[model samples]
Target: MEQGEFALSDREFNRVKARVYKEAGIALSEAKRTLVVSRLGKLIRTLRLNSFDDYLDHLERQGTPADAQDFINALTTNLTRFWREDHHFTHLETYVGQLMQRRPRGENGRPKLRIWSAGCSTGQEPYTIALHLLAAFPELKRWDFRILATDIDTNVVAKAASGTYPETELSGLSPQQMALFERAGGGQVRIPAAARELIAFKPLNLMNNPWPMRGPFDAVFCRNVAIYFDKPTQGELFARLGALIVPDGFLYIGHSENLGAGGGNFKLVGKTIYQARAQQKARDAA
Candidate 1:
């Protein structure tokens, strides 16, 4: 990438970009060298460096786990909001209601509905799920629900787990839900203790071999994330997720993506959503 005669050679740029995609499923297009260089320029300047070569030398030799974290954090886009995909919440409500009705019991009497918000970024998504459940079903207090929120970026995971967000981030939330958020000193809004209690945030690299967590999730939300991976990587990812999700369980993906856009492990269940096959969730339970 050439900018005012200061260019990043193919090898140099690829070295950085490859490291990012390897760590996170995100691939940097050739068009994004400017951003890559611009972001990394801070690290260079912070280290008192003048050339990209020196930065590379440092990254290759002296970059610690902390550098890797900064590298991924800067490169990854963790923007998510409460009910960003509103339809998913509606679907979840309907699904959970049915589960509750079919069993004909209070929250405590019914089997737990396990959910995983993979690629949960900054924690909004999973908390949104919890709040939706709490608001829609007051009896949810009696039920045991677990929402696992995971991301490859530990920094974002920590922020998410803190359950704190800026006031402006509440714009997308409903007034009723917003009422549950409280502004702490310094203008930070914290997710209600109930909602925070519903989630378990952890660091998980989706591309890492031997996925650290296994699940029989009643539903899985893996939206807007696979779009960054190559087709093969995407396919493999869906396949792995398919195995973890229970049969007949729902799978929510990004609005812009489709089932098997990378490979076929799910059947179209809704608008850009899929199911792990009813047989799977049911048979597995049996």
Candidate 2:
């Protein structure tokens, strides 16, 4: 078949869908068939494969870790921008302020302020969080602070690590916010080293077992990630999230995502935001 003429049959599409679901916990509905075709088509063409079956076979035969990562990267949709949801940031700033006021200083030994941006795409979200924190509390520069920005897509993780974005990407941000951070030329901007220093980017598959870091994170920003997961998968992921968060720690999900029927130990506190229940946290600790 020619470059643009490659066809994806139902069998091949379903096979790919199953593989994606099994590996990434992303349930691709029938409506997403076109998306799969369009996105994977580029990969198939680049590999000069005639059909989706050929591409699947290549994936099966190679079975290299990198190949699997590539498969996920090709199909994953990463749509995000700096300060995409302003209210969330406002809430975050207030939360950080409260925490900062309480965090022990000097001889008292201040606890490290930690936040996790799960499914962080292209690094914008985490970078934005860093900037927000810096602007909210300049004194945070003296405290031990860290932001873990992770995504399943290795490519996006690399981009996030680079901390570079085009000027147009700053559309969601205001001039005042822009001015606070360092900027690079060529119609592109790089996150200031000060903000960048607070973040560490890593490639993470949410469905994978034995997560590397055991976190009692102060907050977890998992916006727009669980929508792709089935209800059961979403429940399990949130349960793990509950376990990883500190007592009363906040969990900020996408506007569309919710705790659902099996909300477990999370108490809905705001629009798409939940706080891990103190009672449940105590039980878990016991």
RMSD of each: 3.3, 1.9
Q: State the C-alpha lDDT per candidate.
A: 0.80, 0.87
How far residue 125's Cα lies from its native spot in candidate 1, in Å, is 0.7
lDDT of 2 by residue, 101-173 (tens): 7776645475588899999989989998999889888889888889999999999999889888888887766
TM-score, structure 1 vs. true: 0.88
Q: Ten consecutive residues with minimal summed lDDT in candidate 1?
A: 257-266
Off by over 4 Å in 1: 1-7, 103-110, 261-263, 279-286
Give the alpha carbon lDDT tens digit for every residue of 1-286 in model 1. Answer: 4443335788888888777777787888987887777777777777787777777788779989888777777777777888898989999999889888765443566557689999999988998899888889988767777899999888889889888888888886678878877787687788889888889999888888888777778889999888777777888888788888776678898987765553344688678778777665455457
Write down the worst ten-residue block by lDDT for model 2.
102-111
Best by TM-score: 2
